[model samples]
Target: MSNKRGKGPMGFGGPMGGAVHGGAKAKDFKGSSKKLLNYLKPYRLSIIIVLIFAIGSAAFSIIGPKILGKATTKLFEGLVSKVSGTAGAGIDFEYIGRIIIILAVLYLISALFSFIQGYIMSGIAQKVSYNLRKEISIKINKLPLKYFDKLTHGEVLSRVTNDVDTVSNTLNQSLSQIFTSFTTLIGVLIMMLSISVSMTLVSVLILPLSAILISFVVKKSQRYFKEQQNFLGHVNGHVEEIYGGHNIMKAFNGEEKAVKEFNELNETLYNSAWKSQFLSGMMMPIMSFIGNIGYVLVSILGGYLAVKKTIEVGDIQSFIQYIRSFTQPISQAAQIANVLQSTAAATERVFEFLEEEEESDNLSTPVDINEIKGSVEFKNVHFGYNEDKIIINDFSSKIKPGQRIAIVGPTGAGKTTIVKLLMRFYELNSGEILLDNTNITSFKRSDLRKVFGMVLQDTWLFNGSIMDNIRYGRLDATDEEVLEAAKAAHVDHFIKTLPDGYNMELNEDASNVSQGQKQLLTIARAILADPKILILDEATSSVDTRTEVLIQKAMDNLMNGRTSFIIAHRLSTIKDADLILVMKDGDIIEQGNHKELLEKKGFYASLYNSQFENSEAS
Candidate 1:
């Protein structure tokens, strides 16, 4: 999103001496700079060192103006006295020279201190960003599956990358400078008040007005910057979506439409940025104009007051010098206001994400595998994806240990939803799911899910070796065990034929493999898991006849001692199921063994008859 602050129109995030947001004044940052400052508490010594450097830098600034004032006063007074032929009109160039040398030494020391300050500030920024990045990474791991489903990958990606960088950049570019600006302003004001307090008052009369103008500009910049950031998020989301679905777009001939949408989003971002830039760019020049006006007022009035013997010429000169000193800080404060506001907006987004509720992690008291009996049941379950619509209405079923059950249903019939609910992906609206005669909710979510092995319709694989993918089922499994599982899934033969076999890298999503091989790999993973419950969904749909025969054999072996649930569109695959549940519109229309359901000539009968006739025709 747009981080457009007060700067002239240029490139985005490039090195162009960038500016900051307007809405968030240093005083009005939406998030706690105090919270960010807490990081310094851990390195108080470093903070003290940097503070000393900052003090030295401002001290030199104060001395530099004083030196120039002294030299000017000595030289001018001497020349005026010489013209008047007055006694004690002789110059003290040596003394003036000495004071000027002192100022030079102070400046040289200031440079050294400035270097040290830069180094320490950079260290602090990186250290703070490191901590934030680590904390965010850990927080992501704790989040539930649903959070990812709701927020786009780009949104989260921006948080981890763009947000972290903003925090770091604020520290690196602005942190010490902010300190210097503030201290210099304070020191200059203190000096100004000491010499011709009246002239100092005159010089500062326009100060409040300048501040108000800057504040107004900042407010406008902040509003635009906020909009810019939102548009940036849109741009990021669009690019990610298009890049992710490039192949899909090519297949559907939708490239032009995608590009059109992206261009539109880019145009919006550009407009928001340009307006924010225009407003922030006014801050410095406007403040400089006010400062120049202050100087002009002091020049006229201070000179008049000096002639009237109310103030010395030297005092008038000192007031003018201090005016120059204080103006820089005034301008800097304006820029800080802009920068701080934009950072706050970004911080708001980051912290908002961090505060989201994470999934509960609790392990129910350990269930000894030897003591557990396999039993599962669903009682009048009512479920929905959202509160507004129910997908599963009073669905009921019973599954005994070691029973082979098949669920048959068409699209939108809540077939997949049942499996998801059984796994507790989403809680049911109303009803109880029981495992071993105990309400499933009473079991820990992790512990409950640990009892099952699933092979889904779409296979998922990490970009890793074949052996590593299988080992994902059981991280502790040895290479030999992974090979054994592959053999069980009828995948070992294919693996042996490959150049690198199990050692080969699987590209993202395992796209290097055919659909049939991908299914086999998923079966291999499930085989390695070796859980007490097996769930298959569209398991053999992609495989050819020979491979399907081998997969069915492997599944039969896998189901020998475990409770299994299979959902298949291919009815012939489920003829041997111990029980077949015919589901339509979330209701169980009929259920029985293949032969018994056929004899009844009901919903299951018609479905079976049509499938059998189709097979015969083929």
Candidate 2:
């Protein structure tokens, strides 16, 4: 919890200056502070106890100088007596020893109380951070897909990681210090007043100067901190995007562009970071300088008062000590403005994310997937990512149970959007999709999703063993069942070729394997789940001809007796006697089996012929 970084007693982040965690600046301090208090409400009693210990500790610490002053005065008296050679003027070593003992006791008690307060504060800080992260994790599941579409994974991670960390560090380092510093300030003020009112005023004079210096620095630095945090998020997002697709970027000769963009973001982060750190770093030295001036003034005044016999030498010493203690807390109190500002900024980001619209409630009656057939019907479907423009306008379709429905279209022709609508990933503006005579909305989102298994153009695999990744589809599947699914999907052969076989661990992005092989692993997962309805969105688009043939054969086996919808790119892939919907500009331009559409010589024929001609030319 102590933010002390170097040899100085005063810690920069603790009391002397603002901490630049994530380089964030708070825009709305009051609002953020108010909301943050809501989280602390649960720990109100613990906070009060921390305050009590803090006050007790400072109170005991304040008494130490005073008690030591008494010892000093006694020792001085004894020295003067010895110099004058008075009969009963010998040094009262006994009394001085007793005073030293009492002072030691007071300091020991203060330290004990301080330690307890710090321990309690640490627990409170950690609990608050834990609760915050837990809520964010739950919120992620509830947020609608549109929210994720607009924001990068790194941007969200910034809020969850950097922002949360900022809050945690601030609470750990500053929260108890704020209370202790203010208590010390007040207790030291009282102690100084008791020693000499004039000396207290002299020490107090430096406060306004210290306040002005700290205010100026904090005002200059806060905006930079905010800029630093924003740029950091941008930098993180940029890195995540480039790293995720680094192979493709290298293939396309996009490394230069990626580097250029990264440099721009990094440079911006540097500019703001250095300025914020430099300004915050100035806080302690400036306050220390002002404190020194006050120290000089108090020393001179206290010396004068002692010489005039108005106050004892011991009193002067004690008052000077109190001044040192007093100014530190004042310096800390001044720096608190900056600390609160950073806190507010981080809290605002966290609250903003928490306040985003969650996915619509799945409060409708839950339909059991096992009770229904796989009949799917799209009735007058009208939808678009944007509300003002309708892309899939008045699109209607009906598919019989256990049929393989292939949807073919050019790029940007709404091929994938249709599947998204079917799974309720995006709600329709005005339309209804029924599965087995019941509106899809009638089922809970979880229940509806469980009935359908998906294998998309983009394959996602977690960092786990090959067996574990395959078993992800059906978590309870036995090892034998997992191997069976892999064999059915034609991935068992390649998996066996690996040194670790099914036990081989995948890397972070599963980049240890080829993209085509990754697709096969996903197919094995889908085969294992064995859902009633299947959605394959260009699942084989990334594989080679031979791999595609194997995948197609495995897919054919998987599609048997199951309702399957395939979004295909290769025209030759869907040549069998199954329904084929050729889409253009969000509308179904052609429909029928391969032979029927080819005989018609319509849009489907043209699309088919174009692909054949292009393939032949290549």
Candidate 3:
């Protein structure tokens, strides 16, 4: 039952594997950042308000130290006068009290503005994240299945979850920080210069050193940040793949191999994560060291100026406070720079996925599905998953409105590919597939798919009640219709044996039921659809012999008046088919009814005989 062809190795050149190794630098920081800003366009007014609030908050905080210096000067002068026995020049508690009150009010106003800006920014960030996730969800549906084949589930899920979260968090925390940090830096610089120009010059002398150090760290860290993001996706993909195939892995004694692969991926992630974090972490301490040197130089110079009466003692205190404020935002800006780089990396991956080539759009004037009969025709159809390797070359077939056509062939003989082509899962290279004399291209993909139902060897059942799972075939179906469909698939009796009957809940992986039961539920879903055309690809392969017989009977009833295409490995099950297509190497070697094919003693006869011998031998 080899329904799918074998895929090649997922090498470094593959879509998901391209960034596995290190040295994956951020490709388009400016471009990705610009695109990310577009998401904020709708919230422009709110953002402006946030900026204003942030700036106001920082400005008020910056003014506090200068005003507090006034109280320091007044107390100092009072102490000197009292020590000199000057009664009239004694300290004024009234002035000190007024300064304290004003200081408290200023700080309070700053805190309020800060709170308001944070609240507004959070809302904007969340809305942007919501829009990104919504777009990703819609983009997924528009993407072709082939695009998915080149990537892993975890890789895609990583972009949807981790990448978007990275962008959201940065927007929420960093956007306002930018405004406040810039404001604090400029405001503090002005205050420092107003106190004494010489001290200001001495204090700013360390600027070039801080700038050079920040540049070095950012340059060294950007590539590792990009690599960290890439390996995070790989690690996620590896975990998901291993978890989904846990049973198979254990059965085949593949635990060692799985662990080994995980360790390699985890090791890469570890290396990138630590390197990026360490470089970013170095910024604060390095800046602090440089800031401390400036602090020493400013303190000595301020004392000398005060002794010479060039600046007041209170002015010296205010200048020191300004120096601290100045260096803090520089460090903050440095940290923010690193954060922005990481965000850019994440944003790039997200935009890449959103910009992927989508499936061809629906035709403007689509043929109505209601007018289509079950009749299907493949006219000299040519197709290949890859263009250079033709899987189905010059194949032609015509099916009547109410015929049972069985397609049988050895593994990789293009049996499943035929049905995929008919369903428009993949387009043809140089031919057309027609439904009731009209090209399938004339119909919208949704409309075309609505006319047919498919049950594959791989059963898919989401976590839900049995009744709900069946109703998934047709969302508007009534409970009675679902029950009838279950009965037709011979699964009603099994459902009734459960404690909750049809209402039992399946787990995330639907592991509560046996494999055969899962297959039966999928069959029931197909029956519930009640489509005009049917495709069954080894649909009964998982069931026991007894269950297969019951299901075959149910299938006979369901396919009574519908056009059905059955791809089977066991020739015995399809012996009564109205037409049999025997294929080899993407070409139809023979075609006819079972009796006629047996008389010819060609490919079909050989296949039937081999299966019969294998059954007897077993």
27-135: candidate 2 lDDT, tens digit per residue: 7888888999997999999999999999999899989999999888988988998999988787788998898888889989999999999898899989988999999
Q: What TM-score goes with each of the models?
A: 0.82, 0.92, 0.91
Query: What CA root-mean-square deviation does each model show from the true structure?
Result: 4.9, 4.7, 5.4
lDDT of each: 0.80, 0.85, 0.84
lDDT of 3: 0.84
User: Candidate 3's residue-wise lDDT over 1-618, tens digit each?
Assistant: 111111211111111111122222258999999998886788999999999999999999999988988888888889989999986878889999999999999999999999999999999889888989999999999998878888878579867886788788778977788898899999998888888899999988888899899778767876776667567767766776777678998999989988888898889979988887777667767878898898889889988988898987788788888988887777666556656766788899899999998889557788889966799988998888988999898999999998999999999999999988887888889888889999988888888899999999998898889889999999999999999999999999999999999999998888899988998899899999999999999988888898899889989998999999999998999989999999999999899999999999988888899989999999
| Backbone collision tally, model 2 | 1
Question: Looking at model 3, which ten-residue stretch has the lowest summed lDDT?
Answer: 10-19
lDDT computed for candidate 1: 0.80
Find the 10 residues in a row with the least total lDDT in model 2.
Answer: 1-10
Winner on lDDT (1 vs 3)? 3
Residue 552 Cα positional deviation in candidate 2, in Å, after optimal superposition: 0.8
- The candidates, ranked best first by TM-score, are 2, 3, 1
Model 2 lDDT at residue 205: 72
